[model samples]
Target: MGKSDCSKLHIAMFPWAAYGHFIPFLHLSNKLAQKGHKISFLLPRGVQPKLENLNQFPSLIQFFPLLLPCVDGLPPGAETTSVVPLNQQKYLAFAVDQTRDQVESIFKVIKPDIVMYDFWFWIPDLARQLGIRPITYVVVSSMSAAYNTTMITKETTVEEAMELPPGYPSSTVRFKDEEAPIVLSMARDFGSGLTFYQRINTTFTQSDAIAFRTCREIEGPFLDFVAQGFRKPVLLSGPSFPETKTKQLDDKWVNWLSKFEPGSVVFCSFGSQSELQKDEFHFQELVLGFELCGLPFLVALKPPQGCSTVEEALPEGFEERVKGRGLVYGGWVPQELLLHHPNIGCFVNHCGYGTMWEFLLTDCQIVLIPEIGDQILNTRLMVNELKIGVEVERGKNRQVSKESLSEAIKFVMDKDNETANKLRANRAKLKQTLSNRDVQEKYINSFIQALQDLVKK
Candidate 1:
């Protein structure tokens, strides 16, 4: 009933149990740590060990592991989404949903000034019950939030789901006919008797304030649309990634990349979650596209489904043909560092939010082949709105053709291509703005002030 008083807020960070979600929350926590805020970074017990190496300010950002509740179909030790296949990820979601009790217990102990979370929609109610503010921090672009992300129920028609929300900012953000179903699919039953739509819609509507890892300069209209729709304070984190102060690319990567001439190597990485099925013709098309392009490439992706190893899945003589110039390995590679490598001329990717921003900051030319729903929207933003990249054309059934992939890469790589030249100029300007410290600090500062103001409200 009264204006709350606080200083140096102790915020609890509970992200979705996925590397993509966890890493961005940590990046924000790292930024907040610099401002002297204490963070209680909560995650599954098994995942803490993996994140320890990444915690830059372990002293200030403490890890408080939660005992992950097991689900019937989930694997014995599977704590994150990475261990689960795409079809079976609902089991992982069910497991995460069961953590509300555990989360509430910890919240009672910490009595954090705020609970910053994503995916766990129940957080708002729990935070309110404990008299702690809950902040729903979306790591994805606001454009996706405004255009593609909203309340689409199982009962919602395909046509309705395809239609943009009322007063949505951009007409340019249209989904393809084949891509329209993705919105409905995202909204379908994920787990815990809730669709992803209901989970996000509830959180967005109920959270004390909403935050995004975005800025007003580029995503201003979409951000405004979200604010208007939710009728809450929408704060921006401004793409504040953890500073890689002393980190360097591994020697093996450095040495291998050095062999290629500057601005010659094509780096292909489809995030941690992507795995083309061995049976799918596109998997072969993907590698063959690299061969067809005749460019030096390094692909970092999981081995396809039904295959135990990346080597086993390769087409006949495929490895031999591209042996010396190209490499396709499924292992942890430092993508952020590699993006800045001298030889990385072009980056072919799936356009995950974190990856998109990371690649945008680099001099590497972008060639997008987005697979998932959000990735498709991100690709549209890059190719259609920002004009920063070219997307590989997909067939009616969303199948990737080797010719299309090769053509997209070649188009961007062409020295004298007009469209490529335009993309380069636009991207250069954007790179300057995005990488500017002052612009970024202004957004983060505003976000902090908004949080403090919310306490007063």
Candidate 2:
């Protein structure tokens, strides 16, 4: 098609339907739509509420509901990609395969010009079959993309990731001696083992371009490595978040947080998908520690199935002890809004990329408490490399103790901690470096231009 004909290029975005993936894709879709592209957002039916919130962008975007096939292990009508159990390898594989088929069917209906997908196995083939360009959208940092796509190997398991090479960038290192074993086990047992890596390589080869929600300035070395190694067009969308001009606060949460002094409240939330087992008492210890610290807090709590109730997740009479001081919500809380609230001071986070970026963008003091996957690496980056956060020690079983949690929170939130001040100062400097409007616009425009170039080819 010619340039004039491309005035309204139809782009289909298939994010994994999880909050982490969906939120970033929503931001990208909105940006592309603002640039005059028509977006068909393909997602599971369950994501309607999330889609509802983005109703303002309805003019340039359309929603395509994916009806996931009912499999033996998967819950009936579960659509979000993150719903897959951590241990269920076969079910995840089947779901991915099914999602690909569903996406292909949607393509036939929409006939989009490009198919932008989150990291998945079947996207390339589907795109090729439809004569549409496929773009890989890495929602995390370029460093994360590099780690997953390049550094990870069967022989170089998570255990190996724990011990950093002296003087290496801390962001590139991993924690938890048990991480390697867990990853290796996950990769081997649940995933198609190393086969998933082979598939990812194939997808990378077939993709027309790779796009990241990272700036070259933030992760310059890793971005360069990826660009040089992949030999494919790499687009840096950098901190590609939807702009919120004024801070909006949840009044109740604001009132709750107001109970604490400035730089005192510690907000705790692991992203939506992180599920803690019912038997996991470490979570309880963290809560106890939070109570012991006497910090006013807001926690988004979700326990495993049959234990979904908040009371079920907390220790016996936990809420009673922390009552009037803590606010625990069952489902979604407006996170970005909460982070910007004045009364809110520090973050106790699971280090999900989305959470990390949101916190970083706001220049908030952070306490890194990573749970799984690349989170350990991200924690190291924030605490060790950036010196903006502190890490809590995990016990012999790799569980964090109440004392450790309480101490870490206290250490970071301490008014006298020179390290915390230095971190805040450094964060301010980083923010200034990244606050260029023209530069951000240039990156976005450049990325779109690269996509357009692929179309011409």
TM-score of 2: 0.87
lDDT of 2 by residue, 1-457 (tens): 2346455678888875466778888888888887788899887776866676764478888888776677777666666557666555455556656666677778998898888886565787778888898988878666555554543455655555444443334434554556666555434433334344454555566687888888876667667766666788888777776766565675777677777777667788877776666555455676777888778888876764457576777778888888888766678788788787777888888888888877876656788778766687777767766667788887876778778888888877777889878988887777776676777788878777778777778
Please write out the lDDT profile of model 1 over residues 205-242, one tens digit for every residue: 88988899987767898899998988888899899867
* CA-lDDT, candidates in order: 0.85, 0.72
Candidate 1: misplaced stretches above 4 Å? 1-6, 148-150
Best by TM-score: 1
Q: Which pairs clash (backbone N, Cα, C closer than 3 Å) in model 1?
A: none
- What range of 10 consecutive residues in model 1 has the weakest lDDT sum? 1-10
